[model samples]
Target: MWFFGFSTTNPRNYWIIGAIILVIILTLILKHLAIYLEYSHKHNQEDDESERYKGSSKIDCSKCCSGAIRTYALEELKSATRDFRIRIGVGATSVVYLAELGDGQFGAVKRVMEEKGGSKKMFLDEVSVLLRISHPNLVGLLGFCLDKGEQLLLLEYVPNKSLFDRMHTRHGQSSGTLSWSSRLSIALDIARALDYLHSVADPAVIHRDVKSSNILLVNDNHAKLADFGLCKLGHDIQSAQTPTTIKGSLGYVDTCYLNTGLVSPKSDVYSFGVLLLELITGLKSVQGSTTLAEWTEECRKNKNVEVMVGMLDSKLKGDVNVQQLHVLIDVANLALLENCHGRPDMNYIVDRISSCMEPDIQPELPV
Candidate 1:
């Protein structure tokens, strides 16, 4: 039958099938393109961010490290410490692992790894700055490590824990453990260190993160300031100002600095004020219901500032002259004034506090 051979060819059906296949292939291609574009965009964004961060960062290294401190490489630290085997202490800037000095040396080593801001800059800054300064009350820098992105600092091992440990060790236990003379001595030492940092150093150092925890208690009830990660020099201070990041611990941080980002020499003064309060009250600078400052002020205003005097450690009771106590507390209160400018300079403040002390209160005794 010669009937409709054209129809039997069925060109329309072939066309429909081809169109369907084409549509499927196009859909898969579009899906792949979208994924590739998304991934590429994300990767590009990451690269951009990395470049931006790298450009703004500054890293300046000094000649070795301070005699107070020394530098070691990551490999050297690993070899000396056997990979930080003995975990001793930790600070806001790094983890202090205990290690042997080796080489027939009996001294212990504190292995500190740069953990915040930028590790390399901090490593360089610490070594550079510490190398330039020497002080009796500051911890001695032993050595440091710089490798890849990891940096380690070796410091003289201090056996005693931070002031945080002493202050909060089972309530009155801390205060009772030491004599009034000892506590006062600690304050004096800290004040003296702060004074030196502000006045004597070529460029004044502002211990931005001063607190009891940063104060290391060593042999004979002595206290020394440690950790310079957040520290800045007066000239090197940020130009933009305006409340930078809140870098300090809560209770010990200067309230005025927090509010204004004005980290001057007096910044340490505010923190010392809190420390003084901590010593006087034998209570933590920070406690529940209110801050240490608030509680002290509340009691200070409502009743005689002497109401909380009973909280002093038994070892300190009456050991400190009440008249001297009054003077010290007044100094602390003024140092903690909400107005940063109202605070006294560290040098003047130290001299004043020192003047207020008895002849015996010099290096012979503190508090």
Candidate 2:
């Protein structure tokens, strides 16, 4: 009998076929083994890196702090915060309280809840990033506590609250509207912070979350980028586009990051663009199902200055510099481009915004 032109009953033919089959099987087994070994090596490397940053459950003050971060005992924080009773802000993973540190200094103490798996990771991640970075426009980490099952972070206190509180809250609205100049200044501050993170830092940092809520303001309306929980560090711009889970606030999240599950500095640029739209329109990033970015893009498609100006935050009407406003809108358009490659780097953005603040054009204060 013949099998595919080979004699099936012949001993020599059978031996030849068996040898070929065995060789093919061996090749496949070797290929699979190589793949498994590669994957195991990569995974172990990642775990080691994470372990280096994660450190022990209890941090050692002597080694961790080189005058950059202080290690606080739980009792010290509890006493400063009055047992965490003066709640100033609250989020999914933590609660912040107004604390009176000694010597009449004030600070914000963040208490990380022990309820979720990601909570501890977030705490560790924030600490790791904060330890390595320092910028005037970025929130400063004063100290941290990892004692008796409590995780607390002590941060510099900014009295004016967050940009979100100033823009969206009833109290903020009643107090006084943020002048167009203040808005522009706040935008610049945040842009500088992002620039520092993306360009100046030794290992570039991707904020991962950039929104009005994460922007804390000082009395002079200077903005500080906060919340480094979801940040990622990359040795260079190209390496920054690491694939990871999609995590960010709605509307402000980069569409590219959302679609691909890979994050880059451009993701922060996209979110900053959304923030620019928020500054222009005074609209929440999301209202019902419509996103501020989507809404602004739709309006911008009309190509009518009047139509676009009509969308400005009502309080900003008549006070806005039409020329500057146009410049800002144009910048926003570039930053919010659907293609991440088309987005301008933060340095370019800083220049464009600086152009709008030409020395002669003074900001109009709110009435």
Candidate 3:
């Protein structure tokens, strides 16, 4: 048979055919050897990693993890999420989908995108933190799946959306404005949750990212802190400050943590202060012209109580109690103090906010 002008009758054609066969044989052999080596290397790496994971004290109790937290198969999660069809939330590192689990309960499945900040270390860190901590105001971890190159976290579905969207609603439209009491309640709820994390937890956790967007709301407008990917365990309260890469949103990052690489609960306190500012003024922590912190400082410097009052979200329609506004402003100012140590702790914050909720007392704005 003749192929590409090469015929068996010609000696040169025979040589050419022989060379083509030799090249094909060599290519097949090399490809097979490479595949075998890659497989062997991957198997060894996975074995070593598995051994390390088994010995890790951070997630030591496999029984607890398996029993307390459900581990869904990759195929199951895919089916529940409809191939990630219904996206409820998105962030730099992950995409969250609203899923209907087989058990008939709804869940928010946060799928880690490989190209984003979804490093193996971060994924495990988040899972480790979520596995141990449980509080009413903190988002509950229902389950997780880390198989078949997929990293997903199944969380309690909070229906009312985030505090950010509620507090910073666009235009003049009102989707049931958060009453002053509701705002205070949300603030107190978050404060207690943070206090639990900072003091009550065994090793303690620092919620490195404590922005308003991370605060989710239930149907009743109750606040629940979500997103634990940036959480870090503090060795102890006194020596909580540890050197690490700066991780947090702008406008809310503690200046001390930014300037010095040390991360402590105080860093969270600073961010909480910004959150308080957002709740009180109904302005973003970072405004277009300046930060909420800077704006508040300016108002404080000018001693202009009217300017401060005027800054309250117009959506309230003059319904905000003066006493509550004053208390919120005071708390926010303390939280926004330049010195991290000067910021009030979460317990103190919760106390002040709770006291503000009292019906009888009404404090006038200070001169």
For candidate 3, write residues 1-367 as lDDT tens digits.
Answer: 7865688877779888888889999999999999989977865564354233221122222433343677877877777666776677788799997666533346788999889969888888899999889888898887889999999998877776688867675411246777777777788778888998998887899999998889998743377899999998856754644578999998898888888888778888888888877877778878786777777777643446686678677777878877777777787778767677788788888788878686533221111
Q: Which parts of model 3 have CA positions greater than 4 angstroms off? A: 1-67, 102-104, 169-174, 240-242, 300-304, 359-367
Query: Which candidate leads in lDDT?
Result: 2
- Write down the TM-score of every candidate: 0.71, 0.78, 0.76
lDDT of each: 0.66, 0.80, 0.77
Error of 2 at 269 (Å): 0.3
Clashes of each: 17, 0, 0
**How far is 275's C-alpha from truth in model 3 (Å)?**
0.9
Cα lDDT of model 1 by residue, 1-367, tens digit: 2122323256676666677779999999999999989977865564354233222111112322223344556666665555555555566556665455533232234434444444666567767776666677887666666666676666655556677777665422534466666677788888888887887887878777788878888743578888777777656542446556666777877887777766677678888888888888777767885678887786544336456455455546556666667667778878889877778877776676677777775662222
Badly placed stretches (over 4 Å) of model 2 are: 1-68, 116-118, 240-242, 360-367
Tens digit of lDDT per residue, candidate 2, span 1-367? 9754679988789987888789999999999999989977865564354233221223333332344677898987887776775666677677787776544456788888878443677889889999889888898888998899998898877776788988998756767889988888889888989999999998989998999988998754577888888898878754534578899999999999888888889999999999999999999999889888887787765568898788789987568888878878888898889899899999999888877795633232221
Candidate 3 residue 270 Cα shift, in angstroms, is: 1.1
Query: Which residue pairs show backbone clashes in model 2?
Result: none
Task: Give the C-alpha lDDT of model 3.
Answer: 0.77
